[model samples]
Every structure is written in structure tokens, then in C-alpha cells.
Target: MSQFVIIGGGVIGLMTTLQLADAGHEVTVVERGECGRESSWAGGGIVSPLYPWRYSTPVSRLASWSEGAYPELAFRLLEETGIDPEYRQKGLLYLRVDDEARALEWARAVGKPLSRVGPEEIYSREPQACPGVEEALWMPTLGSIRNPRLMQALRARLEAMPSVSIVEHCEVKGLVGDRQRVSSVETSRGNLAADQVVICGGAWSARLLELAGLQLPVRPVKGQMLLFKARPGLVNRVVLMDGRYVIPRADGRVLAGSTLEEAGFDKQTDDQARESLKASACAIIPALADYEIEHHWAGLRPGSPDGVPFIGRAPGWDNLFVNAGHYRNGLVLAPASTHLLVDLLLERSPIIDPEPYALEGRVGHTA
Candidate 1:
């Protein structure tokens, strides 16, 4: 079996390690912080992009594939670990304020099931819905999973695999590679040899590649979120607008988020951002104005110029690969991203076309 070392312990790294270890490979994941507590834990947990049409083809394909795979994965995780990720098909509702025609066209082109709901119908479905919402585009098949629970389940499952070992609180310094392949990874602890190395470092991916004198064209986009305690079913579905969203969890906690600031790795939550999100949440569901604020936090999402994650081999090194720069959709795209990159590593037929995600012509240059 191949010995693999993955950098970064967010959802991408953990999920990829789970899959790799399940396939009989010896896998080790190194994380600077606790596993699954970065962007993966900080996200709203929607299984699809907030506005699917606004993204690139690579982003859409990976998202679509991962969306399709979530059900079975969630079921398996629940059965194996007894920690339900709370995967629910609660659907997504786009509160329309212009961009309707573009959204309709995108739905048609992508063949996603979408239906227009009037304001009255929307209110009837969700009495807490905000006013001035003329209409909404409903994608009933879209859903969400409790991301922290999902992370818990994944990490638990990975821990159960003897082939998989996680090294946390250990930062990866750099990669030691020759001209053709990466030989080892230099970490805060020590150097570890690997048959292959996958950089699932999320926003920190670019810095990791700098050790090899390469850049991955990925940056950290900080997002602040607010959690509210409300009655269960406060918002019946994921309500999205203007790059912000309201996500209701299985519990009574309603999540209102987020601000996409290009704030490099600063994950400190701002009071101004919290107030802005509260305003948006209240505007969406007026009753939310009365709910108690539960928590506020921020995470640094991996942002790329094209919104497409770098998910293939590194430019020069034959044994090094990347699966980062997912930005806001890391949770939505983790399944397919891990699948495609692992398929490439295993020399198996990929489930999705890998061209758009290839690294050869994209961001990274030969080192």
C-alpha cells in the first residue's frame, strides 16, 4: 500500500484521508490546529453553492458530484460512527431581487430542478420570511449537513482506520522534493517520508508551496458568521441573497452569515460584521430580531481567482497534488474534490472530467 501524507486537517484533508485509508493506503494527516475546525467547521454547511450559476464550470461540476454523493456518505458515516452529520434535504431558496433571468438560465443550462415561488407562497411556506421578497427560486433537491457534526463523524471514522493516523498541533514547514517528485515533508515535529503528498491546506496552501518556490494562486477569504437560538424550523430552508445566507440547523440554532473579506488569515470576528449579518438575518426573517445571539466567529476560506479549486497534480512534482482553494464551497465540494484527486493519484478512471481542475495550465508553475 502507498504511504500518503496530507497537509492541512480541514474537511478536505480529513475526508481525503478517510477515503485513502479505507482503500488500504497508509495515510497520515498533519494539521497546524485541531482537525476540521477551520473553514470546514466555520461554514454554514450548505451542500451546494450559494448561487450555483455564478461559479465556473469546474466549481459547478465538482459541487454537483459532491452534492450527489453526500447522501450515501452521510448514511455510512452515521451507521459506522453513530454521529449523524444531520444531512437533510431541506432545499435552498434564493430570495430574488433581480438576477432572476440569469438564475433561470443557469438552472436550465445545468438541468437543476428549479421552480419559481411567489412572495405569498414563500411566506406560506416560511411564516418567518422577510418582506419585500417578490419571489424566490426553489431548488428542492439541495440540502445541508451539520458541518461540525460531519467533521466529527469523518474524524471518528478516520480514527477507526488503523491505516490512518492524524497528527494535530503539528505544522507542516515545507516539502523536501527533488526535480521529479517530493520525497518528504518537513514539519514542526520532524521530517516524514511519503510515497505521495496532497496539499489540502486550504487557505494556507499557498504558503506551504512557497517552501518549494511555487505558488498555488490561493488566498484566504475571511467570513464572519452569527449563530442564533430560535425555535426549531425557524427558517424552513436555506435562504440566500447577495453572497450572504441564513441556514437553520437540525437543532433550534439558526446561522446567519457571512462577510467575504479578503483579509488574509485574520480569523477574528468583527462586531461590525456581526451587526451587518444580524441586520440581513432580521431582514430575511423578521422574527429573528427577537432571537438570542448564540455565538459569533470567523474562518478563513481558501479563495481562488476563478473560484475553482486546484484539485490535481502539482506542476513539477510527480508525487505532489493539491485539493485546496475551495473558498466558500469547501464543504459543498469536499466529496468530489477528494474523489477526483484520489482517483488521479490511484491511476483510476475519474468520476468527473478532470480537465477544468488540472494544474498544468492553471495557477502553479513548474518548480
Candidate 2:
């Protein structure tokens, strides 16, 4: 069995490790901070893409595959670890609170079922919905997952795997190798050798590559989100309006988020962004105005210029790979991405094309 070392302990890293370990590979995950507490934990856990049909064919394919995988993965983890990821298929309502014409047109183009729901119908669907919510486009197949619980369950299962080792607080300093390939990783604790190294550092991917004398075209796009304490059934469906979303969890907490900022590595939650999110959320569901703000936080999404993630091997480095730059769709794309990586490592057929996500052409040079 191949010995693999994965960097970053977020969902992608953890999920990839789980898959590899399950396949009988010896896996070690090195995390700088608390495991599974970075962007993965901070994410809103929407299992579906914001607009799946609008994305590229590869992206849509990956999203669809991952969506199908969620149920089985959630069930397995819950059965083994006794932790519910709160996987729910409550559907999603995309409303045009301000510009109905454009929203309706876009919804029609995307083949989403459009409905002209009056105040009464809206209230019937969600009694706590705002008074002004006129009409919405509904996609009933979309779903969500409780990201933290999912991470916890995956962590527990990984801990049970004798082939998987999780080393937290072990900051990776750089890659240890020559220009052709990576032999191992240099971490704060010391050097650890591996047969293969996959970097899943998320927003910090660029910095991590720089340490290895490689330039990657990855940047951090900051997103700020807010949390509210409210009953779950109050909003049974996820609501998207005016570039903001309201997600109701099984627990008595409603998540209203988020603002996309092109800030570099800044995890601070700006007051203005938080206030704007609150305003937009209240505009969609007026009762949110009465709910106390329980938490406000931010995460940096790894973004690329073409809105596509970088996966597969980095140029000039054999067995050194990348699975980052997922941007906003990291959670929804995790399963498919991990599957593709495993297939690539195992020399099996990949589900998606590796060209667009290849690290070589974009980064130009190799480490």
C-alpha cells in the first residue's frame, strides 16, 4: 500500500484521507490548527451548488456526483460514529426580492420551476417569511449538510482507521525534495517521508507552494457569515435572495450569510459586511430582525481566475499533487474531487477531465 501524506485538515483533506485509508493506503494528515475547524467548519454546508446548471460541464458533473454521494457517505459515517451530519433534502427557494424580472428570466433559463407565490402562499410555505416576498424559483432536489457534525463524524471514523494518522498543530514548513519530485514534507515537528504528497491547503495553498519555490495562481476570497438562534422548522427550505442565503439547520439555529470579499488571508468579520448580511436576511425573512445574532465569522475561499479548481499533479513534480482552489463549491465538490484524486493516484479512469484543473499550465513552472 502507498504511504500518503496530506496537508490541511479541512473537509477535502479529511475526506480524501478517509477515502484513501478505506482503500487500504497508509495515510497521514498534518494540520496546522485544530483539525476540521477551518473553512470546512465555517462553511454553510449547502450540498448543492449555488446554481448547478450554470457551471461548466465538468463542474456540474462533479457537483451532481457529489450530491449523489452525500446520502451514502452521511449514512455510513452516522452508522459508524453515531453522529448525525444533519443531511436534509429540504429543497431551495431562490427568490427575486428586488429584481423579479431578471431573477425570473435566469430561473427560466436554468430550467428551474418558477412559481408566482402570493403573500398567502409564501406565508403558507414559511409562516415566518417576510411580508414582501412575492415570488420564487424552487429547486426541490437540492439539499444541505451540517458541516461541523460531518467533520466530527469523519474525524471519528478516521481515528478508527489504523492506516490513518492525524497530526494536529503540525504546521507544514515546506516540501522536502529536489526540483523533480517531493520526497517528504518538512513540518514544524520535523520531516516525515511519504510515497505521495497532496496539498489541500485551501486559501493558504499559494503560500504553501511558495515555500516549496513554486508559484501558484491561488488567492483568498474572504466570505463573512452570521448565525442566529431560531427554531429549525420555521424555515424548512433554504432561501436565496439578493445574493444572500438563509439556511435553517436541524438545531435551533438559522445561518444567514455571506459577503464575498477579495481580502487576502483576513479572517476578521467586518461589521459592515455582517450588518449588510443581516439586512439582506431580514429583507428576505423579516422575523430574522428579531433574532439575536449568535455568531459572526469569516473564511477565506481558495479562488482561481477562471472559477475552476486546480487538481491533479503539479508540474515537474512526480507524486506531488494539489486539490485546492475549490472556491465556493468546496463542500459540494468534495466527494467528486477526492474520487478523482484517488483515481489519478491509482492510475484508474477519472470521472472528470484533468486538463482544466491541472496545476502545470496555470502555474507555468514547477517546484
Candidate 3:
């Protein structure tokens, strides 16, 4: 069996480690901080892209495949770890869509559940929906998993696996070896020799790649969100409008977010973000104005230019692979992306085409 070291312990790294270990490869996950305490935990957990038609075909393919795979994974995780990921198909509703024809066509192409609905239909479903909307798009298959709980379930399940080991607060400083392969990892704790290395670092992936003489553009995009401790039934499902969304969890707490700011790595939550999100939430569902803001936080999502992650062997490095730059859809894209990464790493046929995410010609050079 080969020894694999996956850098970054967020949802992506943890999921990748799980798959590699399942294949009987001893895998170690190294994280700069606590696992799952980054973008994976901070996101709204929407299983589909906000605007499906806007993303490229590669992103759509990965997301479409992962959308169908989450339910069974959530169920199995709960049964084994006793931690509920809270996977629910409460559906997603959009107050206004700019390109109805394109969205409908794209929905048909990808086989995702979507339909055009009238204002009355929206009100009948979500009584607290925003007014003055003529029509809306209802996506019955799209839903959310409580990502923090999902993280708990994954970490718990991986902990029990003898082939899997997670290293927290262990910073991976650089990659050590020739261009043909990464023979070891230089970390804060010390050096780890590995037969293979996969860099799953999120926003900091560019920095890590720089150590390998690559210039991939994986910048950090900050998103701020606010939580309202309202009743569970206040909003029936997820609401989307103007690139902002409000998610209602199974518990009494509701999540309204977020702001897409190009703020480097500073994840500081400001008053401006809180007010902006609160205003949007209240505008969408006026009942939210009655509740106090319970939590305000921010996370740096790995912003990619085309919303597609690089998931293939690093150019000029035979045993080095990358699966980062997933932008806003990492939670939904992790399962399929991890599968593709392991597939290429094992010299097996990939689940999806790997041409778009290749590093030499367009992937890393673009960044």
C-alpha cells in the first residue's frame, strides 16, 4: 500500500482522505488549523450553484453528479457515527430569475428538478416569501446539509478508520522533491515522507503551489453571513434573490447570507456586512426583522476564475495532484471531485473529464 499525505483538512481534504483510506491506502490529513473550521463550515450548505446556468460545463458536471450522491452518504454517516448531518430536501426557491429560458434549458440538460411557478405558488409554498414577484423558479431536488454536523460526522467516521489519521494545527510549509514527484512534505511539526501527495488546500492553494514552482490563481474571497434565531417553521425552504440567500435549518435558527467581497485573507466580520445581510433577509421575509441577529461570521472561499477546480496530476510532477479552487460550491462538489482526484491518482479511468482542470496549459497558468 502507498502512503498518501493530503494537505488541508477541510471538508475536501477530509473527504479525500476518507476515499483514499477506503481504498486501503494509508492517508494522513494535515491542517493549518482545526479541520472543517473554514469555508466548508461557513457556507450555507446549498447543494447547487446559486445560478446553475452561469457556471461552466465542468462545474455543472461535477455538481450534478455530487447532488445525487449526498443523500446515501449522509444516511450511512449517521448510522455509523451517530452524528446527524441533517440532510434535507426542503427545496430551493428563487424570487427572480434573469434568464428563464437558459435556466430551464440547462435544468433539462443536467436533469435537475426545476419548474417555473407563479406568485401564488410561491406564497402557497413559502408563506413568508417576498412580495411583488411575478414569477419564480422552484428547484425541488436542491437542498442543504447542516455542514458543521456533516463535518462532525465525517471526522468522527474517519477517526475510527485505522488507515486514516488526521493531523490538526500542523502547518504544511512546502513540498519537498523533484519535479517528477513530491517525495515528502515540509510541515511545522517536521517532515513527512510519502509515496504521493495531494494538495487539497483551499484558498491558500496558490501559496502552496508556489512552493512547487506553479502559479495557480486560487485567491481568497471573503463572504460574510448572519444567523437569526427564529422559529423553525418561519421560512419553509431556502430563498434566493440577487445572489443572496436565506436558509432555514431544521432547528429554530435560520441563516441569511452573504456578501461576496474581494477581501484578501481577512475574515473579520464588519458592521456593514451585518446590516447589508440583515436588510436583504428582512426584505425577503419581513418576519426576520422581528428577530435579533444571533451570529455574524465570515469565511474565505477559494475563488476560481471559472468556478472550476483543478483536479488532476500537477504538471511536471507525476505523483503530485491538486483538488482546490472550488470557489463557492466546495460542499456540493467534494464527493465527485474527490472521486476524480483518487481516480487520476490511482491511474484509473476518471469519473469526469480531467481536461478542463489540467495544470500545465490553462489551469495553473491562468492563476
Candidate 4:
């Protein structure tokens, strides 16, 4: 069995460690901060991409497989760790679908149910959340998870695994060894020996890979979100209009978000963003204005070129792999991305085509 050291303890890294440890490999997760508190915890946890029919092939493939796998994964984590992920099939309500033809065609091809709902029907489901909508598109199978709880459950589950060791507050500094293989991972605490290393450092992936002389085009895209303390059933399902969305939890709390800004690692929530999000949420759900804005926060999503994540062996390195640059889809794409990485690592049949995610044409080692 290979000894694996995974840098970063975000959802992507945690999932990778879980699969490898389950396969009887010795795994150590080297985290810069507390595990499971980054983008994974801060995301809205939509199971599918914002619009599955519109994304690239690589993203859709990962999201498609993961959308099916989540229910089982949630149940398993709850049973094992006694932490509920709160995975719920609340469906998705799109107030405006620009290309109806393409959505319907893609829905038919995927064998998933997509239906048109009039203003009356839309109001019936999300009576207060949607306003002045003539028509809408509804996907009943779409689901969401309480991502913070999901993170907690995964961390708990990983801690119980005998083959897994998680080193929180330990920052990975560099890669040590020849170009043929990575002998160890240099970190803030010390160096850890490894047979193989996987970098799941999210937005910070590019910097980590830079230490190994490769240029990965992963950077931070900041997103800010707000939460409203409302009664249960205020907003039903997930509602999206324009580029923002409102996710209603089972307990009546409502969440509204976010802005995609190339802010370059800035995670501070600003008043402008908060006001903008509040206005948008109030517009979607008038009742939100009545309730108090309970909280506001921000997270950095690992942005990549063309919204496609790099998830394969690093060029010029024999033992290093990457599963970062997922942008806002990290929560939706975690299961499938990690599965594909582990499959390639084990020389097993990949869940999907691995070539699309290969790191071949991009900038290779420069430093």
C-alpha cells in the first residue's frame, strides 16, 4: 500500500483521503488551518451545478455522477459518524431560463424530468420567494446539502479511520525530491515522507504546485453570502434568478448569495456585497426583508480557466497529483473528482474519461 500525503483538508482533499484510506493506503492530510472550514464549509452545497446543461463536458460528467452518489454518501456518513449532512431533495426553481429549448433538449437527453411552471405554480411552491415571474423552469430531482454539516461529518469519519491521519494547522511549504518523484512534503511543522502526494489546496493550489516547478492556473475567486433568520417554509426549494440564489433550509432559515469576483484571495465581506445580496434576496422573497439578516460571510473559490478543474497527475512529477481549481462547483464535484483521481492513482478503470482532465497543454514546470 502506498503512503499518501494530501495537502489541504477541504472537501476535495478530505474525499480523496477517505477513498484512499478505505482502499488500505496509509493517508495523512496536511492542512494549513482547521480541517473542513474553507470553501467546502462556506458553499451552499448544491448537488448539481448551477445549470448542469450549460457547463463543459468535464464538469457535467463529474456533477452527473456525484449527484447520484450523494444520497448514499450522506446516509453512510450519518450512520458512521452520527453527524447529519441534511441532504435534502428540495428541487430547483429557475425564475428565468434564457434558453428553454436547450434546457428541455438536455433534460430529455439526460432522462431527468424538467417542466415549465407558470406564475401560479411557481408561487404555489415558493409563494414568497419568487415575485413577478411569468414562467419558470423546475427540476424536481435537484437537491442540496447542509455543507457545513457535511464537512463536519466527513472530518469525523476520517478521524475514525485507522489508516488516516489529519494534521491540522500544518501548512505545506514545498515539495522535496527529484523530478522523478516527490520524496516528502515540506510543511510549516516539518517534512512528512510520502510515496505519493496529492494537492487539493483549492485556490492556493497554484502556489503549492509552483514550489514543484509547475504553473497551475488556479487562483482565488471570492464569493460572499448572507443568511436570514426566518420561519420554516418561508422559501421552498432553491430559487435562482439572474446570477444569485436563495437556499432555504429545513428549519426555516434562508440563505442568499453570491458574487463571483476575481478579487484575488480577498475573503472579507463588504457592505456593498451585503446590501446587494439583501436587496436581491428581498426582491426574490419579500418576507426576507421583514426578518433580520442573521449573518454574512465570504469564501474563496478556486477559479480555473474555462471553469474546468485540473484533476490528474502533475506534469514532470511522478508522484504528485492535483484535484483543485473547481471554482464554485467544488461541493457538487467532490465525489466524482476524488473518485477519478483515486481510480487513476490505482490504475483502475476511471469513472469517466480522464483525458479531458489531464494536465498536458498548460504551462509546465518553469521555476
Error of 4 at 21 (Å): 1.1
Instruction: Give all TM-scores, in the order shown.
Output: 0.97, 0.93, 0.97, 0.98
Task: Give lDDT tens digits, candidate 4, residues 1-367.
Answer: 9999999999999999999998999999999898888899888888988878899878988998999999999999999999999999979998777988898889998787998989888888888855578999999999999999999999999999999999999978888999779999988899999999999999889988888888998889999999899999888789988878999888888889998888887889899999999999988888898999999999999998888889899987898999889988999999999999999999899999998888889656674
Candidate 1 on 64-155: residue-level lDDT in tens?
Answer: 99999999999999999999999989788788547778888989988999889987878777778877777788888998999999999999
Off by over 4 Å in 2: 97-121
**Which should have the higher lDDT, number 1 or number 4?**
4
Model 1 lDDT at residue 105: 91
Model 4 lDDT at residue 134: 93
**Reference-based TM-score, model 4:** 0.98
lDDT agreement with native, every candidate: 0.88, 0.84, 0.89, 0.90
User: Lowest-lDDT window of 10 residues in candidate 1?
Assistant: 358-367
Better of 1 and 4 by TM-score: 4
What are the clashing pairs of model 1? none
The TM-score of candidate 1 is 0.97
Candidate order by lDDT, highest to lowest? 4, 3, 1, 2
Model 2 C-alpha lDDT versus the unseen true structure: 0.84
**Steric overlap count per candidate:** 0, 0, 1, 1
Better of 1 and 3 by lDDT: 3
